[model samples]
Target chain A: MNSPLLDVRDLVVRYGPVTAVDRLSFTLDAGETLALNGPSGCGKSSTALAVLRLRRPDGGKVRFEGRELTNLTERELRPLRPRMQPVFQDPYGSLSPRHRIRDAVAEPLKVQGTWNRTDGPARVAELLDRVGLDPSYGDRRPHELSGGQCQRAGIARALASRPQLLVLDEPVSALDASVRAGVLNLLSDLQDDLGLGYLFICHDRAVVRHFADRVVEMRDGRAVPA
Target chain B: MSSEALLSVRDLRVAFGPVEAVRGLSFDVRAREVFALVGESGAGKSLTARALLGMVPRGATTGGRVRLRGSADLAAERGRRITLVPQDALSALSPVHPVGDQLAAAVRSVRRLSRGQARARAVAALDRVGIPDAARRARAYPHEYSGGMRQRAVIAMATVNEPDVVVADEPTTALDEERREQVLRVLAEQREAVGAALVLVTHDLEVVREHADRVLVMYAGRAAEVGPSGHVLGRPRAPYTAGLLASLPQDGPRRHRLPALPGTPPAPDALGPGCAFAPRCPLATAPCRDHEPEARTVDGRLVACHHADDLSDPLREFV
Candidate 1:
């Protein structure tokens, strides 16, 4: 049988003496969305960070594509880092203010040793267009774009990595309602086209209910039974 | 018109250099009523709220009149007759002073009260806002209190003066849904306890739907619609209001995609000669592009749209 794209088993995360995530378990298949629904300080973000190995889990197993990630060294995980990417809440903060949008999107490709001088600029423009941004936006800096446009640019940057899974932490919470729908629609279209697994973390229940395929309600670092 | 309104704002205009943020806005806030001003971020709702309090930023030119009880000197009556509950609760309070001490100072600022009497009133105000162990919690600094507690304390401080009007500018935007509801409930209760009108400026339509009695929908620094919240939200006459409502996710079966309004709000300095929302509006006609529609009463609501009368189902285009 084909395994799920991502499997998290009994995940436990700690910050010094405080327990942030306690015995959490969830699994996601390719092209499926699993939302961590909770209020603030409920460990939803900590779980996302641990899943991406941005913060090492104190005790748990993060199995991605049939590989155990918790025991892997930083050197071992470097090659696999592009497979899962994180889209943070603050769009402006995620992208460098000084860098142009094209450079920001192309940085991933260059770092992963896939950049060619011939077609690299074209690829960045393609990525920008794929995420519903105008190709001309690539020349502008993060501050030059609106909140929604910046978020779209951030998504374009994430897509440049050609990731299999995305850990979106309150991706649209900072955007206005009118702009948020467009971003959500773009994300849905990308997931269908790319078959990307999503770990969607959000506090708004209506958004979670509308966007997620399956949901795990969390409170105080523990999953509450639905 | 002047006799019934607790606070009447007429032809309000605020300009920063050549850019006019709020232009030709008018509304009346009745006594003990919840009047909500809702729109997108750059729709000038916040600027309108600041103008009502006579607190527009430095070097900004303001025109028109804001009269409270027939008095145009809003600066003199700011803290005593009307007060503000700001968005950031922590910044509204002093980090060094105890939460209760700040409330006492607010009370003592307007009234000539003894220190002991002011302190007693401060504790009582905290107790009224559902803060547990009000006396002890009052002694804690702003940083010591939780986010929710600090918000409730600010609400208490805003109402402690017993002002005739309280303007809350996106009071609960930073909170989650549960905490948002709790803080809004506290604000509502305090406003009721003090018998003061509330001018709530927010981008959250759900909050306005549940809390407001009357709502003013703004678009591009102009009123798109204004009426009873039930009438306006239920059967919106303006296309801008309808489009905004259609974009919200509901509590039923999930749709594949939300009908979002395309494009962004125009820059304040970049407005065209026609209606502000004409470019993005779905039902825009040639006349809509050539002429700016004036607000007129239709079916017990004020709507500024060239096609307000013809729209049978405003939500139809979106759905």
Candidate 2:
């Protein structure tokens, strides 16, 4: 299926004597959303971390667009970090407290050295606008925005580097039900517009049914048949 | 309200300094029925639950009547007749002690049982909630059990006393569908077995539909709509209720843009002289902005919306 954008093969993550994720394998195609549904501590978050190489796995392989990423060093993985950005569960925790919304969205672009001094603010405004936030919100701090707005800013930051795949770990679980709907619609629209792949980890069944093209249910660190 | 309801809350108000977190909320929960309080984060659902448990924040002041089984003094009868199943089970449980000890302690508080009998009852409670090898698992600590299992243990503890009212606040929000269903079913079964009324506070409309016998939709710390689950959910009489149902994602086929309510719920302290939802209400008029809508009976349902007459059932697509 067009050489899946993010391919994980038999991924294993362990903590001390316990295996948090056991021999899990999955693939994501461009413009496709894959939801990992499970209860808490069913290894959903561990699997996401292992794929991004944020947490080193005990065994197995994680490939990004056909390149093996398991044995890669942190310095070596830095070049590919922008291509697979993360939108975490807690928007407040994931974002920096001191940075303004503009800087938060522009930080990724600055890291890639892609935008010039003159073009950075325009790109930040464009990104914020893309996520359904007013450009004026760029001046506000993270604490000033509501849970929904902060999450939108988080999405804008994830898209700043033009990532091909978004590893969203419970992105909407922190927001209210009404606010979550808007964010989900924004994610769906962004996927259609940018042809992005999503590894959505969620516990809400109704959300999985509505948002994901395919559902993988995790139980006791293994993917079980649904 | 039923004449012989188990728990009757009349004009319950919780105020933290100048802000009234729960403003004049009232409801009745019948024995063995699941009563769900549905709303957003700041809608006072949690606050109302806390008031019932007599655990409102230190500075918050609660007023009006909270009669449990005809007793007006809720604080005097907190643990004896009513108990809380907290949202975060991991924190709700003691980290250092075995789960069995904690459950036994809760059981011993209400019933005059021997230590051995309480422990046996604790194991039985754990078994009732579908925990495998309950006798062995009861010896495990909170951190040792899985999140779902910890929640089950919390449920076991809450119902062990056989209280007349069980207040479960967001019990399944942290669980997935399979585990959520498992915990929900276990709680329902346990409540039924014990002959207790369940006061469920959650933001999930789908769960409310599946489990609740009656529902109270709160907006800005007020009851926006109150009725049977089918009528309130199937035919939302209030604009805010209609908007909340419309905002949920459907089961299949993604819409281009979900129909979202434009703004956030008003802060408790910033509510003006009109309906708290009028600013975000699509059908808001001068009357809605100028005067607060009092609760009125319409078609056998209690609704607090000035434009309730113009609003129609918005759950046709939802169901």
Candidate 3:
């Protein structure tokens, strides 16, 4: 319908001689949620990684807001980096154990020069509040919090840059059932409030059915639309 | 239990020294019927499956009885009697061994099926699990097959003997939505063909809703709720069950918020005096916190909660 916020066309991802994604194409509208569903190794995760240029695709085109992402150099990619953020599958792995909540959330703002040196703490506190965490949690290290808390911190960090696109890789896979529901609810609420687009990666159809505006099924590196 | 039940777990319990993983859980799994256990991690869903095939780790305290209802001499014959199709297909398979040899070992462990017989059966099993080129794939190593295909191989190995019960612990955890459905459908069909009961252990409500005939909801090392899958999942009588049912997101139309259960589930060993869920439950009462509630039949399910009646509030939606 509307011009997509993220568009992928006839893309192919390969691992050595083997082609992982064979001519796959998909598009995500701005502020909309798109779920990539398929068997493990069917190229759903690869497709997500490729959009952020994390994984180099052998063939196809990826356009973000009509700008071709594959053509951008690292230096050229800097400005748009703030508009795209990721929270990976394993929260413990995605978050730095050594970093405190404030520091982690402030890390992106610091990199983007959004919050100047003295105001970083204030920015971090605001982020913590937005994600439903108390300001006291800002002092706690990633290890001090539970899995669900760490995930919330990860979300806070993702929001620190005020990104237009959020790539959530199995965001709640590691959390308990009760906790997962909370996180999913948080994501949807955030999307509604911020007009954000999500590329939600998950194997759980139940989770996808609950959250995503549209569903895409990937198989053997091909986009199997449903 | 009827003779058609493939696996009968009677008060089965497994304790790891100080921690009791499973606290006397019991259920009957009938042939061609899929029985699902849905709960968060550490709820002892996986441990119960391990006990069915005597696979609980050595020295782990195990109590209660397990009987193969219709099958003869399952304890005497493991590989042939009842089998587990492990969750992680890649790790479950040996990288060093060819898929064919691995399948053969599975068959060899159960009975004196000839090498050729095992090969044929393996191919057939593979075919049954929806994998093409079964013969060619048999010669391939575990690494050669895709993750979905590897899972199929694991299923083939488990089904080669045509076991009476197949334990699939989160079998679709690693699969995508379409592939996950494919695998689940294959399991359903394979169970039908082999005349076996399928025990699917997962935390996924959708999987339980679509596939299982019966649902066993676990909490704090006990069956907090057990009954027909539809009834327990849809009109959950237990507070914990209601919370789980409430928290899940639905398709078609989005809701204002998912009603999340407030707190984390308790560790199996450190259960509260009253209800394990009382600490997190929105409708917890004085008795719910003072004493642990025993399971009672309400609307067919055996639910363990004094405030089970409070779960009557209509849940949000299901997509």
Candidate 4:
């Protein structure tokens, strides 16, 4: 069998006296989806943040592609950031309201210094089409699009650098039921095509049951493998 | 007009200047039944709830008849006969006052009860909704209660006066699955105890299927389908309703791909003369694009699609 894309071991996160996440351990193989399922205040979100190194963990190791991310400095982590990206809960907050859809999608490519100003538009359009958005959607601002459209744009933006693993934090929770299924389908298809791994954090059991290959239940900041 | 209908809305229209949010919507809520208004974000589900509670925003014009039982005017029956269980329990309950005081105020609104009597009723209401330590919890401030408990408090407040109709707008949207079930059970129990009709405005189809007795599906400010929950969800006729059900992720073996409706719901301002669902409907034909289809009763369900007659169960393949 191939090596896992993400390996998180004994992860712990704390907010002063409160332990948000406690001794969490999980591994995700390439093209696999691992859903962290639990109720509110279960520390599922804290685990996601810690694994991404967006929030510093209190203890334990997070390894992406066999590299130890926990000990990496800010400067070293910046270059490795593109390999793992986050699709946040709220699309409205995740995407810049001021930036056009094209700019938002191309921002990642620009930040990673992979594409120049001249090469950005074509790549942005390609990404938009891949996420099921029309090329014309590139011209519109984030506010102009619907929640599902905005989320598709968000996915396009996340995929700009072709991340190997996507940390989805309640990705479709903010969307309406009518369109949420479409976005979930898009995510599932994207995973299949790219052979990417997903560390999905969600509270809804029905969604978790359908999406995840394996489930990890979190209770009071502790991971209970299901 | 059905004699059993506790509340009947006829030709309701809510317009904000040039943009019409709800256009000519009509439905009926039977006594002790959960009538769900299911739709997308801009489909005017919340606006209908506001209209039912007589709380439409200022500058928006509302025209229609909201008859409570046999009475035509909803203005007189607003607070006494109808109440609202708002979306956010945190914001719905006043932050400064204790939960008991908030509920007591609601109790005093309809009945000319003494202050002590109202307070006693408020505590009883809280207890009835399954809030533990009702007396102590009632005296506690809104911030002190957990999210689930706060929601139970909100339900208790709405049902304090025993209003004939209770309108709950996405009541469990902010809650987790466990809490969501708790809140739903409390709401159901309270509605049953009061024997009041419930108008539930939500985007969650799972909730509708589980709780609702009847359903009205709104697409782009128009009623797409209206029928019993079993018929609409089990054997949906309208393409929009069918597409929505087919899209939900199932719990069996993993799907190769989730069934999805391609396009998003059209904006109210961008609406055309044709059926609102025609653009995304898999079964759309030329007749669906020219003019809107009238509501046709088929097998005891009202479906407003030209091709609804020809359409099979949309969820057949998914199931």
Top of the candidates by lDDT: 1
Model 4, A1-226: lDDT tens digits are 6568999989999999999998889899999999999999999999999988999999999999989999899999998899999999999999989999999998998888898877778899999999999999999998999899999999999999989999999999998776888899888899889999999999988888889899999999887765
lDDT against the true structure, per candidate, is: 0.92, 0.89, 0.82, 0.88
* Candidate 2 deviation (Cα RMSD): 2.6
Per-residue lDDT of model 1, residues B154-237, tens digit only: 999999989999999999896898899999999999999999999999999999999999999999999999999999999898
| iRMSD, model 2, in Å | 1.8
User: Which residue runs does candidate 3 get wrong by more than 4 Å?
Assistant: A1-47, A55-72, A112-118, A136-145, A173-177, A201-210, A213-225, B1-6, B69-75, B113-120, B127-136, B309-319
Specify the highest-TM-score model's number.
1
Worst 10 residues of 1 chain B by lDDT: B247-256
Q: In terms of lDDT, which candidate is stronger, 1 or 4?
A: 1
Best by DockQ: 4
Candidate 2 chain A: 10-residue stretch with minimal lDDT: A1-10
lDDT ranking from best candidate downward: 1, 2, 4, 3
Cα lDDT of model 4 by residue, B132-192, tens digit: 9898988899999988888889998888888889999999886898888888999999999
| Error at A201, model 2, angstroms | 2.1
Question: What 10-residue stretch in candidate 4 chain A is worst by lDDT?
Answer: A217-226
Candidate 4, CAPRI quality class derived from DockQ: medium
Q: Positional deviation of A63 in candidate 3, in angstroms?
A: 6.0
Kindly report the docking quality category of candidate 1.
Answer: medium
Tens-place lDDT per residue, model 1, A50-158, is 9999999999899999999999999999999999999999989999999999999999999999999999999999999998889999989998898999999999988
Q: Residue by residue across B72-158, what tens digits does model 2's lDDT show?
A: 677767766798999998999999999999999988887899999999999999999988999999898999898789988999998
Per-chain TM-score, chain A, candidate 1: 0.99
